[model samples]
Target: MAKQGYHHGNLRQALVEAALGLIEAQGPQGFTLSEAAKSAGVTPAAVYRHFAGRDDLIAECALQGFRIFGDLMNHAWNDGRPSALLAFEATGRAYLAFARRFPGHYMAMFESGLSPSVTPDLAAAAARAQGVLTRAAAALCDHLPEGRRPPASMISAHVWAMSHGVVELFARGAPGARGPYPPEDLLEAGIGIYLRGLGLIPADTAPDPSAGTAPDTAPADPAA
Candidate 1:
């Protein structure tokens, strides 16, 4: 039977938000199309009005996630402001912050098993989010020796992987989610180590990327 009393200003977006909540609670494959419809306070058949199937709905959610992610990355990079080092580090902090604030969107974008290339627009959005980091990496590499600078793509990928690992292993849900170190510290120090190896920052000093700001007060993690 169809749900009867629900109304919304934007039914499609209503469904997407409802589905995102379900995904956060139950993982992507854990919920059914009927569940999403019910969560949206509509009939199962109503889902087909905005989506071909469950996969299509999840794809839309991922698409929206990528757009938001791209925006966050762009803002964090801030066109390489303060300094390239700080801006680049801000982007890294932004990665953990996004995962912390938007678990459903994060999972939808990464762990949903839906290939971003399922749609051209989705692919573009995913690429745009990643491109911001790549651009930052390229700028930072300008500090290194021209003869031995690794590809910016490789540098960005390494950082992305590290950030994602920290989020998965430490940053999300409850105190001490993983190891002893906070995700921010772990990632900052890790990036520092990586860059020091590349001869970017001074090798002897501590790896303090956002030296102007206190450790907890750095401007990368946006409010949830």
Candidate 2:
């Protein structure tokens, strides 16, 4: 997206961009509306013409983020083409890609502490994004015995938690930043371990995660 800052009729978008930049650089509550207005090259008072306040601006950012996230996850899922397991893995990779590609939006959507119910649109966007993962989880786990199968939502939540942990704990840090063992390898290995535990992947058939312990994953600032 081009940064159309403070254009004739796009002040709303400009302020949103400013808020996203601030969120990425200084966390959600670290900056003020006045600062955001300054960054967007507008008067602080001009912000109210499009948004009620900073939270409103942040909500817009979250809204946009969910839209983009949904698209990425959906694309990665790709109707579970080739193989459900492979597609699911791609979706996991896309999570890291999204956080790297849109740190501002990622922070706003997940780290901002904004209520999921802040707005109907925000809520709907969030649900749609979440639904993609659930669908993928369901597709991948469909072969499980009915009594043994975990709920798709539960599987999706587990994968989401693991992916989020990798990003927060390893991907963003110093020594872990594409180090001797990249976060990507950690995530894939972890996922493999998880699926093996679930019997979705048999140990003998699963890739020897030990072999790919090297940091050979593709370069991405996340999706770079």
Candidate 3:
């Protein structure tokens, strides 16, 4: 069905939204720029006015994803208030929450084949998102012995890997999955264990619930 009352002023935004919906239903490679234009209620040629090609549109989507992900993590971090460890854990929760709430954006940000080098905008956006994780990791290292503290980059990668693994394996909804634990609980437990193993926190320290609850899922903001 052709979109009714579509205006040129809204065409760009419409195309982006359409692309996201397509990316959600199919992987990044599953749709084309022409299809996005059709979904947006515009002619295929209209897409070129807003995006150079499919890769450009995908990069824009990924850039927007990173910006949203960064904001969520930064809000959760809250400048490491109360305690650094607690704030760091909150960031982890935010990561999982973002993944669950915006699976398409999440996939575009990480699983899309586009490399950061493809676009400066995408690279910068990705860096900002990763910077949030790096800052949290640095905060977590405060309790470690000076000599034992790992590089923030290493810590960030380790935590990110763990969170990503858990999200992909258990949280994304597998068939017949009958687990009593929620994804947040599993994430907190895994992060706690990993921190303890790194000696960043004492072996007996329990995870703190007072740090911050995961942010409620918000409507996707594609403006970025």
Candidate 3 lDDT by residue in tens digits, 1-224: 34556775977777777888888888888998878888888889888988999988888888888889989999998888757887888898899889878877887777778897788888988898889889888877766578888899998998899989878877775421535677788888898788778777666533457856644443221111
lDDT string for model 1 (1-224, tens) is: 23356666677888888888989999988999889888878888878988999889999999999999999999999998878888988999899888888889999999899999999999999999999999988888785678877899999999999999888888879535678988898999999889878766665533467686445432221111
The lDDT per prediction is: 0.85, 0.85, 0.80
Stretches of candidate 1 exceeding 4 Å from the true structure? 1-9, 206-224
Q: Candidate 2, which segments miss by more than 4 Å at Cα?
A: 1-5, 173-180, 205-224
Q: In candidate 2, where is summed lDDT lowest over 10 consecutive residues?
A: 215-224
Local distance difference test, candidate 3: 0.80
Q: How good is model 1 by TM-score?
A: 0.87
Candidate 1 accuracy as lDDT: 0.85
Clashing residue pairs found in predicted model 1? none
Better of 2 and 3 by lDDT: 2
- All candidates: TM-score: 0.87, 0.87, 0.85
Per candidate, the number of residue pairs that clash is 0, 0, 0
lDDT of 3 at 104: 76
